[model samples]
Target: MLASVHSEILREKLLLPGETLVVGVSGGNDSSALLHILVALNKNYHYGWKLHAVHLNHCFRGEEARQDAAYAQELCGKLGVTFHLFEFDVPAYMEQTGMGGQEASREIRYGFYRQVAKEQGATKLVLAHHADDQVETILFRFVRGTRMQGLSGMPKRRWLEEGSIELVRPLLHVTRKELESYCEENGLHPREDSSNRSRKYKRNLLRLEVMPLLAEVNERYREHILEAAEAIHQDHAFLERLAIEQLEKVLIVRKPDEIVIDNEPFQNCDVALQRRMITLILDYVSKQTEWSSQHVEAVLHMSGGSRPSAELHLPGQLVVSRVYGRIHFCPKGREERIHMYCYELPVPGKVWIAESEVWVHTNYLERLTDWERLPENEAVFDADRLPGPLFLRNRRPGDRLALFGSGSEKKLKELLIDTKIPRAWRDRLPLLIAGDEVVLVPGVRRSAAAPVDERTKRFLHVRVEFGEDWREVFS
Candidate 1:
């Protein structure tokens, strides 16, 4: 078993020389076997790996949990390896996040693992997830409705924190039965969790009831499921690469708060690529793996058709909007129509707009230097020719502006439409209002009322700084 496991690890290239490795141990058969195998491989084969064992107590099983942590510590001590133990309040976490017992436990457990790996300076974090886990995951995702990405199951090796920490599952090719047999052969007494026998959890019910029933129908159901997952993983990887290429072409703007895509280019892609691109965009913005096939379908539905405008509220507080020839995907409150308010702009002062989360800084300059070379987000206006105290706010009804270089005055709404601004974003766009007149619309058109050519003695330099992407509000 050790020789085969070592060969599998080598084939997978899970470890490199002179690197620190953190192994997650739960005092269960699978993890015990993993720890023992890794230690043996390092000692006999000189794998040159600095190994550290980490155990997280979920604080659910009371005495049994403490016993498991103790056993893990003693086992590591006997093997002359370092041990780290941490405890978490899984129930409290579940209550706080409104998650179930299983999800909260898993989230806290992995968070603890990552924290330990970082503290230990480990480059790779190892888990004992075997082929059985992969099969279970695939079945679980399928039963709950998933896309190809979720059906692909767990990966063998992946970056947990891009470029910082990696996660490796060396036992992915090994079965639970094999690991149990190896533990017995090595005389490793592993603790069994009683919760695994409880049928309250869906996974337990699937493993105890559904899996056996399926096995009765087909003796090799588990093996077949694992094979299917592997195939889907390969196909998903290929499609994901193609989707990324297509995304770069159609993606108009990508920011932490939102992502904009050209409707024509996105609509022209194959259905598979379109679905993948939508999923990629959601995943990138949310930074969470909770998006489902339903969310993807909702986005696709909203972006489809020749409808002038449509909007759909999705999971994770995300809102997908399709306006004219553009698709906007952003957080719920970030979606264009933010609350409108007017605040006095103080000269030589900075004001942070809570509604838009933007900072408007105004400075008085004696004279303008290279006025035509100002940045896109900055504008200089004649201070002496101003109508009254300047006020900054969103576009209001009946707002009109005499666009620069255009003699005729146009309504703010008409100007925005002519400028090709998404209809949904017109209300959220910031404007510098002087008394009843519009002076400057940052990153867009500037009012012809405050043109500064040469007679200006004092100039007001106003700059808009957005905490997130300025393009979301301006472009």
Candidate 2:
């Protein structure tokens, strides 16, 4: 059995040369067996992959948890492989973070694995989640009324954090019973975590109680469950591709944070495609695990908002805003009062806005037609007439600026209040100032003293671009 399973894995994918593989060995039967097989493969075949074992002592089981780490260390020593152990205060962390036991444990364990994998110079972090685990995940998501992505169960590989390390589940096709049988046949010793039998966790109850009853009715229940998960995974991939194509047509993915959805095009899509369209938008905004069906339904119904202006908040801090017959999916924490700064022009060049990446630049001269063509919001000043070392700073309370052409000064606060600039943006907007006087407010207004005149030696060319992805930035 052990040889057959080993042969099956070898038939799948050969490890690339000089590949560094990190295996999570929790001393449990599944993980320990996985480590033993990988170690064997490392030696039996001249596979140039170096093996490193990682164990996270959750500290929930006290000394027994330490014993589990010790067992993993002993196993690694016997196999002559490098071992890493991480101890975490799971209970205290759970209380502090208000996360359930399983959630906390998962977060800590995976976090430790990713960190250790990076430190050990590993490219891939492998886990021993088998077919039975996938089936249980499917059942759990099904009970929660999840979409197809949830029913698809676990994936083979995914990048958790870009450029760090990839998550790989190597034995996903193998069954738990098959792993244990391989360990028994190969004389491989494995530790059994006592928590596995405890019904305190929801997963444990489903595994120990529900799965056994189903298996009693059918001998090949595990195979059937795995087949269902595989089918769902295939279907989910197809839907995801279709959604991505549809999003390219109906969505303006402005940036990683900003996206604009065309409600007119979305409403024209079929009802089945409507759900997928909403899901693609939510995923692009949040990258969350699962969104409820009810929320997707609500977004679909919101295609035609009876209210002229309406906004809705969904899971993962996603905000859907509707305006002028267009629906937009905006990120949360973006709805604060605008902050404006009074900045002094600095050397007639680009200036950076600290609150936002937006940059402002000034050029020497432009055609009269160019000045007129510039948007009223953009500040085009007479560069030569302006003093050097112009400063850019945020707007302050009681700040006053001379109105252009009117030659009358008004308090910045009073103007902002009349314009209905939200109170939060008072301190965030970039204010251009030359010494004691305000020069220009990019995307807002220009100071009177800095207005274009014949005496102006240089015609300023001003434009704004974000710190990142200049091409995708809005004017």
Which candidate gets the maximum lDDT versus the true structure? 1
Going through the candidates in the order shown, the clash numbers are: 0, 27
Q: Per-residue CA lDDT of candidate 1, range 1-475, in tens?
A: 8888788888988887778999999999999999999999899878788888989899899999999999999999988889989998888787887777776777777787788788888899989999889888888888988899989898898877778889999898898999999988989999999999999989999999998899899989888888888898899999999999999999888876789898998889999999999989998876544677888888888788677778887755678888768888888776546777888999999998887668999998877778767876788888888887799999888988887776988888887777767766666667898878898877676777766877887888999887655554444
Model 1 TM-score (2 dp): 0.81
* Candidate 2 lDDT score at position 267: 71
The parts of candidate 2 lying over 4 Å away from their true place are: 7-11, 160-164, 250-342, 346-350, 362-370, 380-427, 431-441, 444-475
What would the TM-score be for candidate 2 when compared with the true structure? 0.76
Alpha-carbon lDDT of model 2: 0.73
Error of 2 at 225 (Å): 2.2
What is the C-alpha local distance difference test score of each model?
Answer: 0.85, 0.73
**Cα RMSDs of all predictions?**
4.5, 5.2
For candidate 2, write residues 1-475 as lDDT tens digits.
4466455556645245578988889998899888888887778776778888889988888888888899899999998889988888999998996776776787788787778777778888888888888889888777767777777788877765556677777787788888888888877777778898899878899988888898789978878877887798898788778877877887654566667666678778777677877777776666533576777877877777676556788755678776545576767777564555444445456666767556777666555545645664466677656655567777765678888878798888877655544343456666676766766655556768756766666667666554542222122
